[model samples]
Target: MSKGKTDDVTGTDTTGHSWDGIEELNTPLPRWWLWTLYLCIIWGILYTIAYPAWPMVSGATKGVLGWSTRANVAAEITAHEGKNADLVAQLLATDMDVLPASADLNRYAVARGGAVFRANCSQCHGSGAAGAKGYPNLLDDDWLWGGDMAEIEYTVRHGIRNEQDDDARYSQMPAFGEMLEKDEITAVVEHVVSLSNADFDAQLAETGAVVYADNCAACHGEAGLGDRSQGAPNLADAIWLYGGDREALTETVKNARFGVMPAWGPRLTEADVRAVSAYVHSLGGGE
Candidate 1:
């Protein structure tokens, strides 16, 4: 039963509803605001008709304009690829070994390779190529294989001891547990440990030296200098893929270490392979 009425105090129309002693005034919205709201409503309707809006079972409605965000993105990608096609072709043609001779190509490869490494190699080798346990640190001075760019490329292409790739770099260290007596294994562990650690038992090392000379010397070298030819690790240098401690050396000598790296050759484009190799070589460890 509320009706509009004029208030005596301000001479403004009252809404005829009051709480306590206060009355509400019938104030209209700004003209500009009302006009804007109407325009928005109209715009929304046109937008629904002109662009993808309503959803269906399989997809959204293709609006009258026949435009798609996905199509736009695909076109953009195609254009980008066209722009870089020549560069990519050049990269592919260039030998990874001599790619660095071209300053511009090297820079481009390194930049591209860094991105590739982050996406693919960073999981095992770390973002900085510092590596984790069981993974060889790419940033280190030592390498199980050669540390140069060409060697890195070969390793990346062929992989290490991977059954999937027949051309993989393959090496075997005999499980001394099967070959050597328990005392001999223990002594060999002591000798290998003494190669790196200063406080090893000299008597045990002397005993292990004979066993080492007989077995480990061929691959690991008499001076324990790792042979890159056989992928044997240098014990005397103290750098270890596993660890250089006595217990670590003991386990390695007894059990043996066989690590596998999946070949990138099959999956990645040649340019990508070279780029990632270049990036790895740029890491402090590379010769």
Candidate 2:
């Protein structure tokens, strides 16, 4: 490499380096572009100093400006709660049984409850509360537990078959596969199917009736109408938590279904439970 020199053709200073006889130009950046770059660097430093940045072990560093997105969100939530304080108070004070007496309060509860249902209950019971396989439908009159507002509230508060709450509605259907023989299970399944289906095997159902009376008459009534006292679903109805088909009934009789609903009493506020109960009741299935 030689010292810096001017090129004869272009009359510009070379960078004093050449590759294969080609010289590099010592061109400078535009003054405006250089200033803009400097300004950007300064702005970035200032922004970091004025806003939350720099991750730490537990959390991010608090900026000098004291601005926090989490705090802003929490403040907005507090403001909304303050606005609804009166309605919430009225809701908690009013008994669930007499909730319908106050149209305004009932409406408020249903609306609020709809939001709560979508957040929590929708995962299992579905958005429309129609329910799915293994989950009980809310839009229909059939309920494992009672469907009245009070019953619905109690179920929501304590839940069904959950171990979290001591007051949870606990019912354990014995897996008859371990107790009854394969032939007896098949007969009982046929009998259960006959309770809802008119086109059932008479001979098989007759045999199943004896087996059912000996085993299932306590929870599911002798008529197979189901008793709500123990959260037993009505076998006579077309609606079934698992299914009404022969195969589904056979599996149910053999293995049994033990669905668990979590106790919302510990997670949700009293008002929330009441509101969701009201919302479920208003879905056109309330008794």
Candidate 3:
């Protein structure tokens, strides 16, 4: 209260300082607000005592409650495992091939497979399975290996181009140029192009038949249908490893092409591989 002056109209003591002749009031903190602040201070003290609050060289202080981040994480995992107990059991007991064809089960498996694919395959095949330049697209109906469910499962389990995988699918198409003469190679290229409905001189292909029998028939078959065991591709189909163009065919005969697919068995669990195989098979091509 102001010692020198008081407001006669209101009958209240005036504060000492005024701004532009207006008086100011000295207000006390509300009881509720003060209590809240006190409670916050108490909470801080209790929290410090109940949990690890001080940092040390190797670790932190183990407080009275013995709470720790590791303990919290383990607790969370335990809770998750409890909730998924049935799913885990079903996955383990049921054969992957015999899983029900019901929509609900299919949706669940695909979702699970999607997670596995992102974790393991997204590096080569994009998140949407839209493969890179050398890698084959899952969305397409073409597959270097057979696109059967069993085939896909086998490929994922054994892997391709995996050095450590003993049962991995292995094949190597040797360079034909090293064995065949230049004219013979040219004829074979012409014959190969002809199989795709590309224009070619009949005489050239006729001459090339001898070259095909001697050089390519062992792996590619006399009909050019290819052998899955050897990983040789069907030459008659429009699909070409390098390209379907004449130039591509010429280069192919000159030097046999070898494409690599990494094995996933070493990188992912068996369950994960099965899920991934199912997902890939469902990608518009599986029998």
Candidate 4:
């Protein structure tokens, strides 16, 4: 191979390499393209120096300009919170029971509460508050611990059957499988089914009436309307938390269901709890 050679046909300089008698040309890149590439590299270096870049052990390096998207977001949040400070103060000061009397305050609470609900409560109660198998539906009037604004507020503050809060709405249904015979438990389930307008064995339900009277009537009322004081759900209503079917009821009576709700009082501000309470109450289920 030669270091430099001229092609006879085109009179262009060869790159001193050839394959199959075809010589490679020593053609230079266009000056404009070369300059553009150089400028891009410079711009990238400048941008990195002027903004957040270069990952570190703790976090990214604070560039010369100290620009931070997180800082910007925090600043915006602080500004918004400052603007809503007055409304939040009023919300905290006002009693939850009579909150609806002030239309503007109630409106603000509901709107704010909706946002809070979507962020925190949506996982269990669903985005629409329709609830799942174990979670109680918030959109219905069948509340285990009462559906009034005050009650809702109290439940939201203290929570239900949780170990975190001492004042949590607590209730423990005895496992009938351990206490009663299999036949007796089955009869009781039949009675519960009969109460809910579902098909059931009349003979089993008749026998279940006696079992229910002896055991369930203490918490679930004689008419199966439930006792809010004890957080006992109404067996008569079709809206069941665990489920109303025979198999589900059997499982419930045997092992018992212990659903827990976290106390929002410790986690959320007073305004937030009240706001969410108001929001839940306004969902057409409040008494």
Candidate 5:
């Protein structure tokens, strides 16, 4: 009854193998299946011959066709970039100052600049530009440097504290310890805190007002409004470059906080730098 059994009616001979009267047949594999297997083997051989398929003592086999994974990847990248070539070129050629203020333009530049900022600046200016201890926040209306487009652009083109660049955006917040007594600085800090609507001893703040006007007014305004050109902070605002604590203010007065905003001119392409400038200016509520 087995498939291997010889036909009893015809008396065809068996394959000379049997088990419990069940005979085995001399069956061969289907020709199509055999040919398919042969084709796969042939493809592997050809592939090995035409590509870097084998490791050698010196190096891998240099296939006859010279095809490389790197080359394939590069080709794909080139194709992808080719599509955006015009947009990138136009952006580069466009003047940053004269850029249109359309939401679309702002959004595009913001998106592009956001990527760049995250890569280069997120460490200092948090992803949202809500700064940490030493760094200044970018989200608010406050600016050590002016918040205007031109001012922002200038800051980006030439960074602060960049010693390498001759024209780096530079400012030195003078150390008042040598100029003013510690008590006087404390009074000024107290006075400055009062200006921002924070609680302060009335007598101390009043006395500090005199110290502020005498020593700090030259850079920080008579009303503690701040001078942007000199990168002086606005003391009247809630935003603080450094913390609003007595200890932090004392430290600032003793050592002076000269925070540096890096120049983007040399590092980034003109388009990218301009886009960043545009994006930063778009943070809103900037005076």
Candidate 6:
């Protein structure tokens, strides 16, 4: 039985633990700290009994209190819905066309619409609705369909070329590669490029104009201006849904450009559709 060593400098007993010239002190913890620590252990045990704490194979223990964070969250959501029930009801009842007439309602619709857009529409249209290479930019006036509130609402509800919606705005461009020769497709691409007034081969464009008129002019118009009725895109404008460059135009002509938009009418509530329409209309490009 050996006695514990002591440090001469501080006159404190060593805890019999030492390494690299350093010795641990055998100092006693404060009574208050020790008591508090015991209290904490007791409290933890009590808490485990009072609330869901113990884990099991199937689930956690449902303690005596049966308290649940999930239940609290559900209650909070119900409360929020209750608070806005009247406003939401009114929005639902209001006609889509008349929505813009009321300033307060319109503002509310746009605000709520923005949230819905971010959650639902942002994946394709982009967070800011700037669109992508295949997607049409909502921030620009170049719309395959019209951009007015009513028009936008209709488009949003029915969608563009959605197989699910029978009434979806449907149009298709014939794959020129299947019909025209490779050289003819290239010439058509050059002519289409020239419509945007971009630099192109003059000789090729001259030859392509005849091919375009025979195959494309019926929908695209003689001047290459798009027909809104048929959902045709205006080729004369600088804005292009897909790119305006020679390569992009060439690919489009050869393979055909078909974009599908899912109809929101069946999925979203009527109020949500109206709200999103209003929100999209507020973005600078909306007609």
Number of the predicted model whose TM-score against the real structure is largest? 4
The TM-score values for the models, in the order shown, are 0.76, 0.88, 0.69, 0.90, 0.71, 0.84
Order candidates by TM-score, high to low. Answer: 4, 2, 6, 1, 5, 3
Worst 10 residues of 1 by lDDT: 1-10
Model 4 Cα lDDT, one tens digit per residue, 1-287: 66878888888898999888778988889999999999999999998899888999999979999888989999998999899999999999998889999999999999999998998899999999999999988998999999999999999999988999999999999888889999998998999899977577899899999999999999999999999999988889788898888999999988888999999999998888999999999998888
Tell me which of candidates 2 and 3 scores higher on TM-score: 2
Q: lDDT of candidate 6 vs native?
A: 0.89
Q: CA shift at 43, candidate 6, in angstroms?
A: 4.7
Question: Roughly what TM-score does model 1 have, to 2 decimal places?
Answer: 0.76
Clashing pairs in 2: none
Candidate 4 achieves a global lDDT of 0.92
1-287 in candidate 3: lDDT tens per residue? 23546676666666666877777554457999999999999999999889999889998889999988999999997897688667656655666566536455555556767888888888888888877655667777666678776788889888776687888888888888898888988898878877777588899998888789888899889988888878888888777657777777878788877766777787876666777887877767666
For model 6 the local lDDT of residue 277 reads: 94
Q: Which ten residues in a row have the lowest lDDT in candidate 5?
A: 1-10
* Per-residue lDDT of model 1, residues 182-277, tens digit only: 899999889988888898899999999999999989998998998998899888887778887767778888899899999999979888998899
Per-residue C-alpha lDDT of model 2 across residues 1-287, encoded as one tens digit per residue: 78779888889898998889888988889999999999999999999999999999999989999998889999998999899999999999998999988999999999999999999999998999999999888998988889899999999999988888999999999999999999999999988888888998999999999999999999999998989999888889888888889888888988989999999999999989999999999999998
Error of 3 at 246 (Å): 2.5
lDDT of 6 by residue, 175-208 (tens): 8888999998888888988887758889999999
Residue 184 lDDT in candidate 4: 93
Output the better candidate (1/5) by lDDT.
1
Q: State the TM-score for model 2.
A: 0.88
Cα distance off (Å), candidate 6, residue 58 = 7.3
Q: Give the candidates in order of lDDT, highest first.
A: 2, 4, 6, 1, 5, 3
Candidate 2, run of 10 with poorest lDDT = 231-240
The lDDT of each candidate is 0.89, 0.92, 0.77, 0.92, 0.79, 0.89
RMSD per model, one decimal: 4.3, 2.7, 7.1, 2.4, 8.0, 3.0
Candidate 6 lDDT at 94 equals 87
